[model samples]
Target: MWTTLITLAIGAFGAVAAFWLGIPAPFLTGPAFLVTLCGISGIRVAIPARLRDVIFLIIGTNMGTAVTPEAVATAGKWPLSLIILSLCILAIFLIGARLLQMWFGMDRMSALLTATPGHLSFVIGLTDDLKADISRVTLISSLRVLTLTLLVPFIAPLLTGEPLPRLAPATQPMALPALAAILILATALGLLFQRLRVPAALLLGGMAVSSLAHAFSITEGSVPQWLSLPAFATMGALIGTRFGGVSFRMLAQAMGASATLSSFAAIVSLAGAYAVSQLFGIPIVTVLIAFAPGGLETMMAMSVLLDANPAYVAAHHVFRLVFLTLVLPIVVSRNR
Candidate 1:
C-alpha cells in the first residue's frame, strides 16, 4: 500500500514535469499513474470483472440518447459510407500490423493482434488466450492507445477549433418513476442480449433500447452526464495498471519499438480519417474518432471533450472493436 501510494505520487509528479517540459506523454494523467502504483506496490486492484460491462452499458445508454430519428435517418441514407469507413480502418490496421511485424520480427499473429488499436483489455486477453507473445502484443497495443490518446486531443482542437459546440439542453429531468422504468427496461434488454451471447451486447443492447426510447421522444431527459466521465476515468486508470507488471528490461525494449510503431500508426490513422471526412462531408472530428486507434473509452472521452458527435464517434469505435475481433483471428489463422 505504501509503495503504491509512492508510485502514484511519482507518476503524478512525472505527469506535471512532462507537461512543464512540453513532452508528448500520453498516459501521464490517466492510466500511467495506476501502472506505476501497481508496479511499486505489487498489488493488484481487482475491480469486479463485470465493471467493464457496466461501463459499456453507461456508454451505450449515453450514446443511444444522441441517436435521434434524424441521425438514424441520415445514417440510413448513407449506410455505405459507414461501411466503407469501417473497412478502411480495418485495412489500415492490418497493413500497419504487417509492417510492424516485419520491423520487430515478432510472430505475425502476435504482431497483428498487438498492433491492433482496439480495447486494451480485450486485446490483451485475446492475445494471451491465443498464446501469442503476450509481452510484445501488450507493449505495442498499449503504446498505440497511449499515443492516440495524447495526440488526438491536441490535433482535434487544431482541426476542429477549440470550444466545440455542445448539444442543446435536454428537457426537464425524468421523474423518479420514469427513470426507474427506463433503468428496468435497459437492464432487461442487457440481460436478454447477454443470454444470446452477443459480444459486448449487454451494454450495447441497453444503449440501443435507451437510444430508441429517446429517438421516439419517450424520454425527455438523457442519461446524466456524470455517468460517463468517472467510469471512463476508471477504465483509463485500469489500463495504466498493466504497465506495473513489466520488468525494467522488458519496459525498455518495448518502449523503443512501441514508440516507433505507435507514432507511425497514429500518423497513418489521422491521414485516413482526414481523407474520409473530406470525402463524406462529415466533420473532421467525427472522422478522427472513427479512425483514431485507441480504446472506446479514450475516444469517447475525447468526443465529449471536443464536443464532436459523441454518438457517432462511439459507434465507430464500437464497430471497429466488433469488426476487428471477429475478423483478425480469422485473418491470422489464414496467414499462419
Candidate 2:
C-alpha cells in the first residue's frame, strides 16, 4: 500500500515533467521515464502483480468503451486491410529478430521476444514464464516502447506525408452505472480467458466485453477521465519497474539495437499505414496510430491528443493485440 502510493507519487512527478516538456501522452510516458530512472539507480519501486492486473482491467474497459456500433461498422471494412497489415507487422518482428540474432549473438528466444511488438506487460509476463533472458528481453522491449512513445508523434507525419490535426478534447463519457456494468462484465470474461490460458487475458477479456456492450447499445460513451488518470499512472509505473533487474551496460547495448529496429519499424508502419489507408479510405494519421508498435494506451491517448479518430485507432490496436496473443506463443514454441 505504501509502496503503491510512493510509486504513484513519483509517477505524478513524471507526468508533470512530460506535460511541461510537450511530450505526447505525458501522463503515461512521463511517469515511465522517472520510474525507470529510479529503478536502474537501485531505488526500490514495485507494483504487485495483482495490482498490475487490475490496472490492465481498467485500461481494457476504457479502451473497450470506444467500440460503438459505428466503430464496429468502420472496422468491418477492415478485414482485408488488417490481414495485410498483420503480415507486414509479423515480417518486421521476424526480420528484426534475425538481425538481433546475427548481430548481438542473442539466443533465438531472447531475440524473438525482444523484437516482438506485443503489449509490453504481456511480453514481460511471457519472458518470466518461459525462463527467457528477462534482462535482455525487458531492456529491448522497454526501449522499443519508449522510443515509439517519444518518436511516433513527431515522425509519423513525416512518414505519411500528412499533417496531424489540432488537439480536440474527447466528448463521450459513459454513465456511471453503465460503466459499472462494463467493468463487471470485463472482470467476468477476464477470469474465463485466464482459465483458457489466453495471453493478456485481463485486458483482452475486458476489452471484448466492453466492445460487445457498446456495439450492442447496452452502453455508450467513453470511460470517464476521473478513472482513466490513475489507470494510466499505474501503467507507467509497470513499464518503469520492468527495468529493475537490467544492468546499465546491457541497457546501453540494447538501446543501440533498439534504435535500429525502431527505425525499421517506423518505416514499416508508415508504409503499411499508407497502404491500408488506400485500401480502406481511413485517414493516414488514424492508420499510423493504429499500426504503430507502441502500447495500447499510448496510441489511444495520441489519437485523442491529435484529434484523430480514437475509436478507429483503438479498434486496430485491439485487433493487433488479439492477433499477437494467438500467434506469438506458437512462434516461440517453434523457435524452441
lDDT of 2 by residue, 1-336 (tens): 786777778888998777777765666777888988887777767889898888778777776766655656776777777887698779778998998889878888888888887576777777766757886677787788877776766775675576543323666889989888878878899999889876567877767787788778887887787777677767877778767666677788888788878887888888888898887888787788888988776676566555566667766777888887888889988877
Clashes of each: 1, 0
- Report lDDT (Cα) of residue 202, candidate 2: 85
Scored by Cα lDDT, where does model 1 land? 0.63
Off by over 4 Å in 1: 1-46, 119-131, 163-174, 226-228
Q: What is the lDDT of candidate 2?
A: 0.76
TM-score against native, each model: 0.77, 0.83
Quick one: best TM-score, which candidate? 2
Error of 2 at 128 (Å): 8.8
**Winning candidate number (lDDT):** 2
Off by over 4 Å in 2: 107-109, 119-134, 157-168, 295-336
